[model samples]
Target: MGKDNVTVLCNCATDEMVKDEALMDIVTTRKVIEFMEELCEREGYPKEVLTDNGAQFKSKEMEKYLSERSIDHKRVLKGKWEEEAWKERKGKCDDEAWKERKGKCEEEAWKERKGNCEEEAWKKRKGKCEEEAWKKRKGKCEEEAWKERKGKCDDEAWKERKGKCEEEAWKERKGNCEEEAWKKRKGKCEEEAWKERKGKCDDEAWKERKGKCDDEALKERKGNCEEEAWKERKGKCDDEAWKERKGKCDEEAWKERKGKCDEEAWKERKGKCK
Candidate 1:
């Protein structure tokens, strides 16, 4: 690399940028640096870097980045292509033939840049003139508007009219919306209340029906239990009477075994008791 050629600082930079609303957008600065590093790895290092006087060029991050990569750069200046190119291209040099071609290229680029600068200046002046004319026309228009507005309404009257108009518009809109919403709500509430009343009546009627059925069932169960208990008691009474009859029969058998038959049998027989 010779110092004759210029390296676009965009080469040394990756595609990162500083995009701010109050300033210009330079969103690809970091990306440009990374691209530069890749160039150093793939191709050779460039001579030097030429950049604009943007804050990003002088930023600490950019400085550190360049310093770490050992890249040199300078701010672009006017009417100093040779010096700028020497500074921009640190040590990048091709063959002598290429150098000659680069000189021709540099000459053409300088002329073109000068032409562009002139054109840009002319355009800026024209734009400024148009802006001034527009500002003057706008000022006149604003003054006329103020005059017309003043003729139409004074401050106090304008305020009162505007407030009343706004109030009436707001009230009309609000009342319409509120009435619609209230009507919907009232209809829904009436429907819900009717449904609730019907549900309550149905629930009460069902409860009464269930209660009557349960009471009848309970009464039947109770009567069955009482009947069963009475049958058990009658069975026990019959068993007691059978027991008494058996005991009396056993006593008569015992008297016969003792040779003391009944009075009728004793009078009719002598040893029939045997």
Candidate 2:
């Protein structure tokens, strides 16, 4: 019997007696195979095996094992056990025998009833059985209803959460993309501005250098022109002074020669008169 009060009965068909039994929290195909193997080893392999159409019994592994052992496998139809049992009982007993047994049971029941105590007991048992059956049916119905309602709630919650998550993800992605694009644009603009400024600075520096060079060249040319003019003026002054000195020396020599010629002429005249 399972925790849910579901019972599984495993037995052989020959004597309808349980040879071996196992209580498991969860029964699986592997466990079933092992159980059957142990049973076979103890009782020897049977010629045939009969079972219901359970997943563990009808599985490929079970079928293969049975086939390898040359065991004929049979499956009884589900929900027909009661009918089969009735048929078997009918085959074993005739109608006259059933009527005889029924009459004997009635007579015994009437004799056993002393002071309505057995009837009261029977009524109590019947009431208890009906109550248990009703409770079982109610529990099954409530469980199924709860499962259906829970399934719908879970689905709705999942869909709502999924939609919210997707929306958030899309927003985040969009924001990141926009931020990246803006950064790229700003970076390119700044880079272009920097390049333009650098080029302008280079041009300004070159112009300043050229202006200084031109000023130095002009100063050098002015210095050379002044030195050449000073040299020409000194040469002309020296030539004028040399010409004045030569003219004065020539005048003095001419005067001395004339005085000597006059003296010699006077001495010759005086000696002739004496």
Candidate 3:
């Protein structure tokens, strides 16, 4: 790919490269920011980012975006990118050669060192090593067996303890439940008894009050009827006595006037005869 279209990100510590071919379409400050964001989200944000002084990387917006996230942005000096690239290639080559030399040297040194001591030590220590190995194997087996037995004992003890605890807990819960039930039943029975006694008392009091009220009402009604009847009889008797006195007075006045007229006529007849 052309250098103009390709963008490369490298880890300074690992010398690992991440090349973005997507920048071939169009590279702008916005696109650069978006790629950085996506990269950071996928991997992680870098402490420092070194890029060549391209317009997209040098823009104020790009600087602001990097600064806001606390990422240090470094612009490569003129010709520094190419120089660094050359140095990196040369360093890699030198490192590979050095590693090859070092590996050969280490292998030769180890072979010489081992050749001097390994055979004699092996001959001398073979029996000792076997004895030590046997002891270690025996110890390991015994340890495993002891651990197994201890584990079984611990498990059985734990089960027994757990069962006892559960039984005690169950018995406590049952006792508590029974006590609560008994208290509730007793309270309910007492409440019902009180209610029944109260109801009977209330009924008896109501009946007595009702009977007294009925008697008072009947007496009041009877007294009122007797008073009205007495008043009616007294009024009728007064009216009959007044009417009889008026009739007798009128008859006596008429008889007195008739007797005076007859006496005057008899005096006139005696005068005529003379």
What are the per-residue Cα lDDT tens digits for candidate 1 across 236-269?
9889988988888887788776565465566666
Model 1 segments beyond 4 Å from truth? 1-5, 10-26, 78-274
Candidate 2 lowest-lDDT run of ten: 1-10
lDDT score, residue 121, model 2? Answer: 84
Residue 261 lDDT (model 2): 62
**lDDT values for all models:** 0.71, 0.70, 0.75
Residues 160-195 of candidate 3 have per-residue lDDT tens digits of: 999999999999999999999999999899999989
Best by lDDT: 3
State the displacement of the C-alpha of residue 19, model 3, in Å, after optimal TM-score superposition.
Answer: 4.1
Per-candidate total of colliding backbone pairs? 31, 0, 0
Worst 10 residues of 1 by lDDT: 13-22
Error of 3 at 70 (Å): 1.9
lDDT of 2 by residue, 1-274 (tens): 1222211224333223233333554556787778777666766777776566678887899889889988787766897655554554475466658778888888777777643776788889899999999999899899889999988899898899988999999899899898888899988998999889978988897898788788877777777777777767766776776666666666666666666666666667666768
Considering lDDT, which of the candidate structures 2 and 3 is the better prediction for this target?
A: 3
Model 2 per-residue lDDT at 33: 77
